[model samples]
Target: MKIVVAKTAGFCMGVRRAVDMVLDASNLSQEPIYTYGPLIHNPQVLEMLEEKKIFRIDTIPEKGSGIVLIRAHGVPPEDEKALKDAGFTVINATCPRVVRVQVIIRKYAQKGYSTLIIGDQKHPEVVGLLGYAKGNGHTITSMAQLLALPRFKAAVVVAQTTQDTAFYDEIKVWCKTHAPHYKIFDTICGSTEKRQSEIRRLARENDAVIVVGGKQSGNTKRLAQIASMAGKLVTHIEDASQIDYKTLSSARSVAITAGASTPNWIINDACSKIETNLQKLHPIKAALFLLRDFLLKTNIMAAAGAGFLTYACSVLQQTAQSFHHALIAMLYVLSMQIINNLFTIKSDKYNHPQRALFYKKNRTYLWVLAVISGGAGLYLSFITGMLSFVILLVMSLLGLSYNLKLVPIISKKGQIARIKDIPGSKTILITLAWGTVTCLLPAVANHSDLMPVAVIFLFAAGLVFARTAFFDILAIQGDRITGKETLPILLGEKKSFDIIKYALIFNIGIIFLTVFTDLLVKRAFFLAFIPFIMLLLISFFEKDNLISGAHKEFIIESSFLATGLIAAVI
Candidate 1:
């Protein structure tokens, strides 16, 4: 079975802003934080906010304290003033598109024109838009209602930011024919229009459509309603648990989409659940899927890649094959990667739903395994030599402290924290660690010359850096939400990709240059081509729309296996 995910399925710009605002407030505010209402219509997001102690207040308190954020659906100006008057700090997170509608209404209202809003009257966005009309606002959901209304001498028409485009267009036709003198503005948000358009295309292409979002969200419900009009089997589910496997199993292809307020994690979960259910229908496919998932979840593929990289680096140093060094590299990376995943599961909730669930379910067992692997790796390092053991031990300690708060807090406002908090540190640290273990540690144990090993270290680090940064680019949304300062987030996606591209090109160039100069073994030059191949694969994955997330990950990880294969052959 084929599963297609809409590119515009998850949170849109406005919803993302609201969520980021609330999360930042929760993280930075010393005082309790409260949103004037539920930040968005998604219940899963509300639960997450509640978990962070960011509550919602439906009513304005007599004496408010701490910070109160305006919802994504803008509230009335008076309510905002009331919150301020009640002694609460207000951070308005209203969608800028909605604000544009408000501004249009206010501007025309000042000229004595009444306001006509095309949307559900009770929606928070419409309610807020109404406040800008200065007592001359009316709402109609359909053309018949607009036809029944008394004709206005002068009026401005607008839409709730998430209003249906076709319905609003029909209203536009009615007004053009029946009330030509009235002013009309297309206030439906661009993001909303794009999402609706994408879903329509998805519905046409797939046998089954799954809409994931909050049931109460107006835009979400409208998506389901519109999808139903396509006559395809459509399922509107709040999360993965509600998926209708019976319906999904019979379909040849399925399309997954989500409302503007939905997060990537929810959409990812829904997709993963459907795929898992479909896999169970065939024993061979199920086994293969399980094996692939197991290898990824346990970081075994990544560890194998590390082992391969170690082999390549050793060849560069003109050293004989050392399975012991490779094994140590594999175990050390597996330990650190698992522990890092354990700490980063929050971001993974959005970035990698299946891995997040795996870590959650087997938390204790995985932690124990990480500790044992780390200890065994260190023991093997000690057997290799005192220098290898000390270096590995120090790196292990640094890895363990990556997420721990290390900086002292001098005051309430002054606190330096975890190494993870440092801007663009994740990619750099990961690259350095991988380079040290795979190249430097082994080189030191073998008593190789410092200069040659340093050159080899740069080559190894460049490969890992490109890989880590590319994943970070794919995971930008989740990392931003979880307040991680990864390289992609700090530098932006396009720049990060450009950096990765150049880094890959540089690695390839250096490797070829060394080979031509006879600075290292001729066989090692073949390993350099590995990054060039990876560059092509990564470039292709970015450009291809049909490639699934799992396929992309597997292909990227498999790129490193070429190193081991070529080293063994040569």
Candidate 2:
């Protein structure tokens, strides 16, 4: 079986903008936050917001407090004034396309034009549009209803932003022939149009179509309606659990698409479940997938990568007993990475659902592993040398304190009580820690000369920084919702990617340069290929997303093992 996912699936621009606004507001202030109604039609998102303590108010009280955001579907002009009159600070998160329709209706209503809104009468957006029409408003859902209305002397036609484009088109044709004097405006949102168009093609090409979204969403329902009209088997589900796999098992190919309000995680989860169910994998393939997932979820792959990179760095610097340093690096990284994932469960819930579940179930065992690994690393460093031991101890203390409140005397107005609150701190701290374990500790232990040590440290730190920042770019959505000001969120994804690519390029250059300066063996040039490969992977993943989340991570972690391979070959 094969699965084809529509690229247009998932949250549209207006939905994304609204979600970002609400999340940003929740992150920045302690005020009681509320959306005027459900933020979007998706139940999962509504549950997440409630979990974050950002609730919604369906009604306006005589006196309100804190902040309340207008829904993405928007509300009437009078309701906006009422919320302000009720003493709530209003943030208009109304979809811009919906706002455009409101503007059109308001402009013409003042000129005594009856507004003919082509949409479901009870839908939120259409109701909002009706408000702008004052007393001169008529909503028609069918051609019969459109014909039943008296031909107004003066009228303006508009649509609900998510209205069915084909139905709206039919209305336009009828208006053109029967009421040539009436004015019609093309108001269906571009996002909606593209989604409908794509679904038509997918329905024709695939054996079955799976539409994921809230049933309440007008656009989502329309997608299912359209797919069924295409004469293919269709299943409209809210999430992965609703999928009726037995019915779909007969299909050779399936196309998956989601509504504008549906989130990426939900779609990803559904796709993963569907694909796995259909595949019924062979034993070897199943084992490989499980092993890869286990290594990533336990942070073992990442720690092993650190160990390999440390060994390669040790070789470049001509250190004695490089294996001891590699063991230390692996232990320290395993400990810190485990603790980091534990504390980041909130973000992980969105960014990595499977890992989040694993951590939640194995929380106690993970804590024990962190303690054992951290203690073992310190003992190894102590036997190596006093300087290395001291350095590792201080680094461990900092790692432990990363999520803890270390800054004192913070007032309620200031949320900067933890080191994690500082923007871009995660990437910076991760780089320094990795560099210290992989490069600085080895140098200090062996008493390497200062110049060569500095060069090796730069090479290690550059790669570490690039790796951390690249993952941050991937997790920006989850981080923003969970209120973590990571490097990508601070500088934006494009800028961060540019910086990461540059850092990787610089690492390759410096590692190669070390050979010319007599700082490293000639074989150091081969080790330079590690960062160059990473640069290519990052570049490729950015342009195309052929790889799934887990497989992509496995390949990236495997890149570090390449360094060890090259070192062994030489």
Candidate 3:
């Protein structure tokens, strides 16, 4: 059987050193052997030790001068004292990289600098490092955590051996700005960095990447995350035996990488299984993958398009009271779909092939729906009056221009396809269009005053700009990858976050203005403001994950509903 192995495999320098120390002590000592933990994360290696009569004890077992092997993770200073006091022969197998972190913390602490460790606080390595420090130290998991710490006169920062380098740098910058004096020691292990860099290179070169390691291993999880960041589909596995044949069947090129502790033998076994299994894939499975990909993209586009349309309709209904006005408002929504489809053709072909396939298969059906919906809306506007029809026509043209010509200009310059790509472009065009056709167009057709319509536009403009900024921040990464110049990407993450912070402040200002003008009641709006504030707080903390996008959408939509309910009651 042929086998393929990753370049980086088996025990790393640190793990090898630790394991050798344990084995050497077991052979030389006359006492019964025991370890503080499994020694390393690999189950096979731990089982092999058990077969050789090695055992484990959480604390020094009562009764004899037995040998106790410290795990690669290392233990706190207090635990080391307890073992020494118990009269057991202590065999130290702690990884050198972890020990260096403890030394750095202690050195800084003794010099009167507050120590800060950036990683998961619950990890044994962090806990051990904390024990070496004399004074109260802080453990920061995210940028938001930095806000809760008191201003320190001087600080020393160190990272977990396997934490992402970029995240560490971000924390370092924050500390420098907030503390009087700050020192950063980059303690991430070289072996872990080499493995992660190799995985990133593999992900960029291949259609998909597979990372094999124990699920509970921190380094293994980091490897998978790094691959995903490079825009590759990554599947993390415990061993080669866990390879999902179905996932690999259609992959044209697959790159495989493994964590430091994974053995070469297991990697070879998995590659063999993948090659053999891929050769026998049925036609039905291929068809299913194609079908699933098409449905997923279409669903995403449809959902986004529908959300834009719904917001347009709601803004219109606030000032318009006639059925004819609502119908004209729907025409602008129809035009937006037609426009988005026209500009997305190339992107859908390259980055999203499945969506391109769907468009090819259903272009005629989609175009026909666009025509019917748009024509019906125009006819409703005509029935109300000639002026209403002209206004609806202009709004339709503006919506079409967003995707038809404007988006193409940005795309040629390699920018993300959004109207806001043009700096200082007011959403006033879209917002006014929505508010006029939906609210004022009908009111005019019914011969009513336009004061209510003017007030509605003012409120819609502020909300529209806020929503645009929120989305830009959320899509910053995708925009950067595609070479689109958006506010967030141009400003960087910290500055972008600051901009959003101010945008929220501006939104509150608008609410105050509305109250003074008596367009909206302060009491009713403030009632809904409670949830909005909660949502903003959640968004601040959840900025680092995909869940943040979902949370933001939920909060925005809920706020809209709550505000509408309050309006109805008033």
Q: Can you give the TM-score per candidate against the true fold?
A: 0.91, 0.90, 0.47
lDDT of each: 0.84, 0.86, 0.60
Preferred candidate (lDDT higher): 1 or 2: 2
Which stretches of model 3 miss by more than 4 angstroms? Answer: 1-6, 60-64, 279-570
lDDT of 3 by residue, 1-570 (tens): 111334554457777666656666664466788888667666655665675578777655444467887777788888877787787777777788888888898888998888888888887677778887784678888888877887778888889887887788788787677664788888988887777777777777777778877776777778889989988778888655677767665667777777766543344334534544554464564454344333333433222322343333343334344333444555545545454554565534422333455666777876776777778878877777898788877777766766445344454357655453564332344445545654456556756445544544444444444555555554443333233455654555567556555655665665556666655434534533633463476355335331213334444534444443444454
Worst 10 residues of 1 by lDDT: 405-414
Task: Give the clash count for each candidate.
Answer: 0, 0, 2
Q: Regarding TM-score, does 2 or 3 come out ahead?
A: 2
Worst 10 residues of 3 by lDDT: 542-551
Off by over 4 Å in 1: 342-353, 404-418, 421-424, 481-483, 492-495, 522-525, 536-549, 566-570
Report the lDDT tens digits of candidate 1 across residue range 349-440. 76677899899999999999999999999999999989999999988877876887644323334675677767788899889899999999
- Pairs that collide in candidate 1 are none
lDDT of 1 at 213: 95
RMSD after CA superposition, every candidate: 2.8, 2.9, 21.4
| Alpha-carbon lDDT of model 1 | 0.84
Assess candidate 2 and give its lDDT: 0.86
